[model samples]
Target chain A: MQVELQLFATLRKYAPDQPLDKGLVMNVEPPLTVSILLEKAGVPLDKVKIIMVNNRHAGFDQELAAGDRVAAFPPVAGG
Target chain B: MTERYARQLNLPHWTPETQQHLAAARVLVVGAGGLGSAVLPYLVAAGIGLTGIVEDDRVDLTNLQRQVLYDTQDIGVPKAEAASRRLAALNPDVEIRSHRTRLEPGNAAAILAGYDLVVDCTDNSAARELLNRTCLNLEKPWIHAAVSEYFGQVTTLLPGGPCWQCLSGTGAPADPPPAGILGPVAGLIGSVQATEALKQLTGTGRLLVERLLVWDALLPGWAEFSYRRNPDCWACGRG
Candidate 1:
């Protein structure tokens, strides 16, 4: 299965090679979860404060389907 | 209507009726920091009937960069008081009230009662959650916005609609270190929040409810992602 992965704010550091606006495509095995995908994509799970799967809020255990769009955002606490 | 709102009333979509709606609207802006600096001025200028500013923090030297509601001489002054004074000077026709305290669970409901809408301009997750729950319980609409670096996110949560917990879950993330931010970034998001509040109040345009609008200064573009209310969401779910 392939998923489109986008990282926001400081989470972009995890994917330094990818463009900021364009997400990368990840080919993973079946039944991939958000936590597993982040680990595979080199994003530290602790740094992610919000997760969206196909634009819907998702949990770490959320299972991703093929061609799903996933976005992870770092904690942005500043005013 | 007075000449003060003549320009807005002249707009194609707004009329004396819209101006009256604005004058009858009451809104509570929960923070007097950077985002509040942007949110309060526009609401007051738009002639909201009663604008409540809730901020417990005193002005600090480091706040002048983006907290536009204060001045260099206002250091050590309570933000709510300072913001109220400044807003009053901008539009004396609008009533400005100051709540010189934080929005904690203990007093959140009382402070939020009697307001038609709320704008969550606080920087921390705890306050955001508190506002979400209180607004949800009260069945009121609230706009949430946050800024860091060059990125900002804005969303309007209608009662019984998707909420902050639906996006981030029940746990509050630990606060990140003080990050660098451009002054205009906050101004931009704050302005967007104010626009959403106006639209919600006067029924001018489509609301941002159920959509998360993310602005990246780097991309200089907006990306909107849609979300649904979680059936199991502790804040607004049926369960």
Candidate 2:
């Protein structure tokens, strides 16, 4: 399946070396998740605060369907 | 009535009749810090009939730059109380209610039950989650906004639509960002929130529902990303 991966805040650095706006695309195995993809992409799990797939909230175990757009953000500091 | 609202009452899009709906509306602001400071005043001035402020913290010396509602002497005082005092003074016609309690899962629903709309100005993940769930359960429209050093985001969560939890997931991310915010950034975002609330209340303009409007002051641009409901989302999902 082809999944679009996005990251925000400190996690933005892990966009596979792309600019912050251009999301990363990855061909990964099926039954994938944002957490699993992060591990696959070499992201330190400790750095992420929340994960959303196609803009809906998901758990680490939530499976990714084909064409899923995954956006990840670290805990940002702001009011 | 027209004479009272003659200023905004005459805006091309918004009129005295729309301002009446605003005066009859009840709004809840869930924080009194940076975003709340920027939002609450405008809502009151715009003629919102009732306003509720839910804040558990007291003023700190460090909050002066953005928390415009409180003064130097108000430090260490309850934020809700101080804010209500100032907001009440801004518009005597509006009813201001102060909730000096934390937004916890246990009290979320009850606190928001009576309001027409909610503006989320909170600075923490836990509170944000609770507010999202409560708003979902109540089927109320809510305006969500957040800001950082030079970046800000806002969204409107309407009933039967994708909610905040559905958009981000449940629980605090293991490592959430500390609530580090610059005053101006919050001011901008909060003002947007107040604008959305007015729009939603008066039935004018499109809302940000299901779309995350992200702005970068450093980049000096704005972008909105589309979103949908996660059928399995713990809070807003069908369950």
Restricted to chain B, the TM-score per model reads 0.96, 0.94
lDDT of each: 0.88, 0.80
**Candidate 1 has which clashing residue pairs, if any?**
none
Which runs in model 2 stand beyond 4 Å of their true positions? A1-7, A12-42, A49-71, A76-78, B1-4, B170-172, B175-179
- Could you give the CAPRI-style class of model 1? medium
- Residue B68 error, candidate 1, Å: 1.4
**Residue B44, model 2: Cα distance from true site in angstroms:** 0.7
Model 2 agreement with the true structure over A2-31: per-residue lDDT tens digits: 888876655655654745555678899887
Residue-level lDDT of model 2, residues B1-239, one tens digit each, is: 56656788778788667887888899999988899998999999888999999999999999998888889999988998888888888888889999889988878898899899999998876778788878877899998887766678888988999888776654454435464566787888888899999989988889988888877665466767777787887786666
Per-residue lDDT of B64 in model 2: 96
Candidate 2 local Cα displacement, residue B105, angstroms? 3.3
Best by TM-score: 1
lDDT of 1 by residue, B75-186 (tens): 9988888888899999999899988888888999999997999998998888887898888888889999998988899999888778888877623568788888889989
